[model samples]
Target: MKSNFRHIGLAKLCGWFGISRQAYYQYNWETISSTLEEEMVLMQVRDIRSRHRRMGTRKLYEILHPFLLENQIKIGRDGLFDLLSANHLLVRRRKRRIQTTNSYHRLRKYPNLIREMIPTAINQIWVSDITYWKLGEIHLYISFITDVYSHKIVGYHVG
Candidate 1:
């Protein structure tokens, strides 16, 4: 079929395909360029992920932006996302459980006093919370007490 079509002119071939000759050439160029760009982006992504395994798509796009500019490649955030997704290169967010407040601790749990209480002034009620922070390979727990009225961090201790 391709051999038979070779006898016809390019204009007629494009016309039969419901496209202009210029469109056919343009589409061909775009496909080739996109494939090349995808390859380049994937290579860079793999290299970066080697060191930073948990990097998200937004950060990857930022890193790729300047690299793309240097390599004369053009791709948007969504395009990069789709490319990464299609290639199975997109990182999955891990649901890490950091036990800040142990529910099963032997100590008796305190009642929620703040549920019914409203603060009218600063330091009237200090709400305390424990949150985990990741610094390099170490996991640190931050215990903070915030003033309910002012919504300011009154005191914080990191362990």
Candidate 2:
């Protein structure tokens, strides 16, 4: 009968079989392949991603293919994607919410006073307006004074 531990490092074999390395190495003297080409490829991929995290699979494939081909390594785009997914190296895109006017508030509307009036000199007329902002748990109001002649802001205050 062939001994289960005849030709492999016990620790590595245990790691492959999901067993305790200490327990297996204590009783066995077997070793797996010393060539870790696959592991090396994975590490390289991770390193590239760490440098250019925003890159997608196509970009990553383009960057890695030359190196891999030079080393005579055979891997396809899909294969690389699968490897990245398995290793949790795939980049995720976050979707941002689009903000638009709701036009649902029940408030009084005002008419535009400068619709027909055009400023011809500095300080000919001053326009003022107020707006509100929510800061933390408090609401604050901001007021601004502007010179319509020069179209410059004259004063502003926030509370």
Candidate 3:
């Protein structure tokens, strides 16, 4: 059965199964090591990532160094980074901030409606505002209409 399922070569088998040649090679390769050390490193990485989900590799390396030393487990920073990245535990970069404020309109500005007055009933007044958000190359305008009395979003439109 195994011979029937296997092809003449790894590349041929990978091609027959519609798998990437590179992926097939990687799958066949094995790294046998002390499972105890691997588990310890993984647990440390998991705990650090859980506590600080936004921490990068360098910071995590510094944090893990002391703990690993305490347990007499030695692992290089580059190796730790590789381990974290391989296991999909590395932090992703945050998106750059895009300014949405225009302040270029010529329309006359209206006076403040609330004037620090607190509404005690629903529908006492409605406050609305417009903001811009970047979507790809085009700028989108989002308008929000909210009821000041209940602090609820009554209406919203995006264009």
Candidate 4:
């Protein structure tokens, strides 16, 4: 590629590509500058993470504002996100789901009998569910049986 460019000349090649030689050089310089900026940002991010391991991008960007201004670096929130994502430096969110049932218990497992059942009339099928309501510091368990066809609560118990 270097030999081809030397034989054909860069200005003619740039003209063939519908761009001026200066524009081509400018593009190359922009790439180099962007790479240097990203490297600097990564170093700052690592330094911050060393102090706060679970720091997220938004907080990091906020903390990095002064450093960025001092270093004359310009990067937006989404640009920082992209840089962290590409380099695998982004922090992952923990799953918030609370496990309410243990399916792997040693007790005998019962098959779901209502899998294919569709209620054609009222009282033909009833479905039951248990849920909890938070009352101040206590969780009150509420169990209810509902008529499938009418979509009404037939019976309920709070404990």
Instruction: Find the candidate with the highest TM-score and give its number.
Output: 4
List the global CA lDDT of all models. 0.88, 0.78, 0.81, 0.93
Q: Between 2 and 4, whose TM-score is larger?
A: 4
How would you encode candidate 1's per-residue C-alpha lDDT over 114-142 as one tens digit per residue? 89888888988998888887889998988
Ranking by lDDT: 4, 1, 3, 2
Error of 2 at 141 (Å): 29
Kindly list the per-residue Cα lDDT of model 4 for residues 42-107, writing each as its tens digit.
999999999999999999999999999999999999999999999999999998767576668899
The per-prediction CA RMSD against the true structure, in angstroms, equals 6.0, 16.3, 17.7, 5.6
Show the colliding residue pairs in model 1.
none
lDDT of 2 by residue, 1-159 (tens): 777766877677778988897767644542332135456678888798788878888888898888888877677899888877877888897786555456578897788878899888898889997877766799788899999888799999998
- Whole-model alpha-carbon lDDT for candidate 3: 0.81
Cα lDDT, model 3, residue 129: 89
Per-residue C-alpha lDDT of model 3 across residues 1-159, encoded as one tens digit per residue: 355564388677788999988877666552333456768889988887788889998888898888888987768988888877888888889998776567679988778868988888998889898998766899888899999878899999998
Name the candidate, 1 or 2, with the larger lDDT value.
1
In candidate 4, stretches whose alpha carbon ends up further than 4 angstroms from where it belongs are 1-6, 99-159
TM-score against truth, every candidate: 0.57, 0.43, 0.41, 0.62
Which 10 successive residues of model 2 have the least lDDT summed? Answer: 26-35
